[model samples]
Target: MLETILKSAFEWRNQLGLLNESEALRIFYGPGESNHPELQHLSADLYKDHLWLTAWKKISSKVLDEACEIMTRILPFKIEAIVLMDRSVVASEAEVVTLRGTSRSGRFAVKEFGVKYLVQMEKTKHPGLFLDHSPLRFWLQQTQKNKTVLNLFSYTGSLSVAAAHGGARKVTTLDLSKHTIEWAKENWANSGFSPEAGDFIYGDTFEWLPKFKKRGEQFDTILCDPPSFSRSKNGVF
Candidate 1:
């Protein structure tokens, strides 16, 4: 048994007890963990009954099957399904497959601190919510009270929704993807906000930033977190 499996199983077994059925959590981190070079290719996340396995490097089918089998036997959750996502290739070409059970709709609701967000398991490479930013989102929810907030590069508007949920007078979310903008709207609605609760801008942020500056627009808080390997209009694009 690799240390990764033992550590992951232990963590999942214990952590799920602390959270309700509505939450999402990172079971273990391995890819960049200097302590675990033996299986740096893998990491896992828990969303309700499902488990998402992200492979930062390609693993042989035999090894992957073995890993999945071990995972099913040890995890205490209901085991709705186990999803493997390969992050070793181009984002467009990355592979996502189910090794056990089924995701049913490939989408489910995941919560953080009782706040709801939609998880699209197979839509894109991302599993709806970014588990790494759970604290940041919670911070936005705690601090933005009766103020205006701007979330730039807001994929799915998770931060914006958090700000609104915390009583922000207004929240504006800007992103390049209309698809994700709509998805963001769904997330906002999932968090118990009305569809008309906030502003969702679907356009190039570069163009919109200049326009906002020209208008002398201001926000009490601004959140900017961009994806690492994004495609700008041309390259990013």
Candidate 2:
């Protein structure tokens, strides 16, 4: 069952050249594998030099071993590592576990539509870049020209970077985490954007939305991608 499932996954991967090479890809999504019910708990993403697994539910070590062995044997290119993210636990306690090999210095520099983002594998809740949003980023890069953009709950400013790269007149990034604001600045700088290229807001989304509304601040585009709870200083949103 494992071998068949993985083989089909590779076949799907081989056919994904239809997507632009510059965009990052979620090569194998497990829940989308509806035929094999148990395999739905797992998904795989291919990065520049590694394969990343995300598990929503726990499985036996034997099943995990089989999956890793098959991936290592079947993949054509040499991989730096095969990492697993066990998301069965709450985000606060989630772990990025390396099941096969080690990532170089725990950082893998990846690109989407020619935009650079440094992804971390070990000891990080998320690797900074979210591969699933690849197409949306590409859309922003193509469509945001000469527009003013606002990114709410922006993490690491991947979207803002895309919008700015598309020649948006101004890109404003708002986030609750100061770390993410700094991280976004680093990414923007890495992509050849000046520090003054964007306005970074470090505050709660609930508080800021009303303020923006009251102030009559208008933007050509406003993006909001919040976490599950959306709990903030004001309350749940």
Candidate 3:
């Protein structure tokens, strides 16, 4: 099983030109339609200095050993850590299983499309950025000039950062987590945008959206990516 995974990873590296750069990337993806029939339960993501492995089912020690060996052989740079996670759809929290190396405390930056985002690998289910949304970021960067943008359920505000970078006149980011709001500000600063350029609101989207509407606030563009389920003091979404 490990040999098959390594073979596919090496093939993907060559096909994707992954080894030519030291950037965040999805080295492998499984557990979905992209998965190979035999390796349908595994996935991997490279986050700057870390290698994040994920599984939809139980993974054995032997597979972990082989994965580490293969990663060492394929990577051009030394990884600071190799962390495994459980990404089952029904799982409520991301479970970390440190297969090798160690991660530093607090947040670190990962670059994509020349924009830097602050990520906390051990802290949240998504760590701070969502790599799959790169195309949306690109589109926002190209088209958002002078627009008033609103991002709801704005996790760490990556989309808001994208909008601001594209010269949006006003960008508003709203989320329930105060910690993530602060983290989003760090990402905004890292991307060379003024903190004052963005309005960071920490509040429940269900509660805030109506308030914004009542206040006659309107946006040229709005991003609404809510979680599948959520619970707040006001109600569940």
Give per-residue CA lDDT, model 2, range 10-85, as digits (tens): 7776776523474246766778874565567888787777777888888668888988888777766677688888
- For TM-score, the strongest prediction is 2
**Whole-model Cα lDDT per candidate?**
0.77, 0.80, 0.79
> Model 3 residue 20 lDDT?
52
Clashes of each: 7, 0, 0
- Ranking the candidates on TM-score from highest down gives 2, 1, 3
Evaluate candidate 3 by giving its C-alpha RMSD to the native, one decimal. Answer: 2.6
Judge candidate 1 at residue 73 and give its lDDT. 67
Per-residue lDDT tens digits for candidate 3, residues 2-119, read 5566666667666766545436677776654244443467777888888878788766677667767787677767888888777654666656767788876678887777777777
Error of 2 at 78 (Å): 1.2
Native-referenced Cα lDDT, model 1: 0.77
Best by lDDT: 2
Which regions of candidate 3 are displaced past 4 Å? 4-22, 32-38, 88-94
- For candidate 2, give the lDDT: 0.80
What lDDT is reached at residue 209 by model 1?
Answer: 90
**What TM-score does structure 1 among the candidates reach?**
0.88
List the candidates' TM-scores in order: 0.88, 0.90, 0.87
> In model 3, what is the error at residue 146, expressed in angstroms?
1.2
